[model samples]
Target: MSSFRRHTCVAFTAAVLVIAHSAAPAMADDIPGKIAEASGILNDALDFSQPPVLPTIEAPRKTDIRASIDRGVAFLLADQNANGSWGSATRTKGLNIFAPVPGAHHAFRTATTSLCISALIELESGGLCQDVAAVAESIDKSEAWLTEHLPNLRRATSDAIYNVWGHGYSIQALVRMHGRHQADAAKQEQIVTLIKSQFDMLTRFESVDGGWGYYDFRYGGNQPTSSSISFVNGALLVAMAEARDIGVEPPKRVVDRAIAALRRQQKPDFSYLYGEYLQYQPMRGINRPGGSLGRTQCCNTALRYWGDLSITDNVAKNWLYRLYVRNGWLDIGRKRPIPHESWMQVAGYFYYFGHYYAALSMDQLPAADRAPYQSMLAKLMLDRQEADGSWWDYPLYDYHQPYGTGFALMTLKRCLPD
Candidate 1:
């Protein structure tokens, strides 16, 4: 192992020992059992089995990627609601995920709209879109809708904190909006104000454990008692960093606590527990490598962006390689309707979300190191586009296609040759 990887392992082992030593004392008779259990958990947490050899991937033609992006943009243009938002609570399935009334749908629409707007902004900025006029119009309409509704967004119920996703994603969109209108000082100021509001919302909804979680089943109080979920923290921190790049600093207390929470859940191999609640059950399928395939990318990127030196270029490349080689683990769960029903408890929605973050993680590497992974990601996305010109991995009311396409578009844009 490299020196950094060795240091990470030693540091994590020491932290675990400190926690154990600080715990309440046990009787002599109980010592053996406790030791055995701790040993088991530690062993599970340190599983570092070598991944299968990397497979060769061919780069797709740039023209092919351009065509795919054009189709995706066209789909978004045709799918926008009359109100200029992207998703609604329509298209119910018999086994739909629980979404409580107007609030959940409100969060969903805001998040979906924000993603669509970000995608359009990225393509327009890169000069990748064939229909620039139409794309600009869609972005303007959606940006107006988001600015109008985002401040009112909140937890759907005390138990449902899905709005955190909306808040995180909206912050990203607002950052893009801030840049897209840089020449318009008035519009940029308005976007800056909106970005600050999102930071406030994240602070308001941060889990008591430190980061954020989608569910608060523990106490359902005003201040959530949810366990900090690893990937949610990854998404939120990344967005906050983007806002910071544009002169909008997030609350330091919130950022520090979130980084701490995420670090606690990370194992020696860098596979994270699904949530802090799963800390003891580190050997569970969902917490293992195959299960962590989608999460490691985002979590690593978030930490790297926040100045975690251990997340080196090699670490980033290793995870990106795993994402491509073992992608079937995630693909099997795609469009299955039920979350975590597939092997390793992999969920369908993680498909595009994972690749999207994988693309972000790829950006952390040297420009010379990004080409192979870019080609690999582009091919994966291109192969999955639906005949309707959109991409979806799960059935999330009417929201899936829009959010999926939005993620896919941004991801593909990253794949374009620099």
Candidate 2:
């Protein structure tokens, strides 16, 4: 038997034994029938059939990678709005993600702008950017727009707290800004103040259940009553950790609760639930590995960053392997227009988002261990670059290309050799 089958069978046997052990003595005679039933359920849930083997793709040359990054940077520069930000309410399609007026757009624009700023900063810092002068100018304009507008960002409506994304991503951008202006003590102090204000916004908007969520369907009060979303928590936690690295400590209670909430959603295999609301239906497709292809990387990286010892090297590597092998699960949903309209209910937005976090997870590995995955990740990003030098998965108004390119650029940056 093949190694995949061998492992599956062993897992099946162990599962059956565990089930049989919990059976009552009176039902002992029905053990065989019970085992048959258990086998069926396990097979359906695990899908133990061997996946098709994809050919090994060699890493692209460094020159090729640099060229791609330059193209992506050009896309972001060209796509920037006159106000020095990225993304607007333009380019609406038949179906669009709900963004309630100025507030939602504020959050969307802030988050997208934050991502673009981060990408430019990272590439510039790495010395891979070709247009150094232009990049610096763009970063300055974006920093001005972000610091001015981000402070006013808030929930779009009672039910939509999309600003959480803005707060989380802005913290990340601010950290980069803080680092970039180290020589200018006054500028760094202002960035630090902005970062703390974002922290306050997060605390005010944190879900009553702990962590952050974009929706507060339950109560939508000043204290949001939304369920703690796994990926949202993951993103926020990672950003908070980055802030902490710069001596900006997040609220311990908030961090602890977010971590706890994330842990609650994490399955033994590391696949996370779509949100806390889906906890009851743990077996639902959206909560399974296929549905979770985009989430596990971010979630795992968050836990590891916050000192989750259980997320060892092997665990991180296994998820990375799953991400590469089952990348089609995410790929099939790309540019689908509608959200969660693909197989396994995979949403189009998760595509670049997943790969970005996967790149971050790759960073968790030792220097020597990252090369192969870096090559693999670079191949995936390079394969998907658009003729316009941008990468977009979902059609979210005019935000997709800029945000997607931002994520792709950052992901590709991690793919570069140290």
Per-residue lDDT of candidate 2, residues 22-114 (tens digit)? 311212234565542232223233332322122355778888899999999999999998889999999998876777898899899999999
lDDT of 1 by residue, 175-274 (tens): 9998899899999999999899999999999998799998888899888997999999999999999999989999999999999999999988887888
- Model 1's C-alpha root-mean-square deviation from the true structure amounts to 11.3
Residue 255 alpha-carbon offset, candidate 2, angstroms: 0.5
| lDDT (Cα atoms) of all candidates against the true structure | 0.85, 0.85
TM-score, per-candidate, Cα-based: 0.88, 0.87
| Candidate 1: residue pairs that collide | none
Candidate 2 local distance difference test against the native: 0.85
User: What does the lDDT come to for candidate 1?
Assistant: 0.85
Cα distance off (Å), candidate 1, residue 362: 0.5
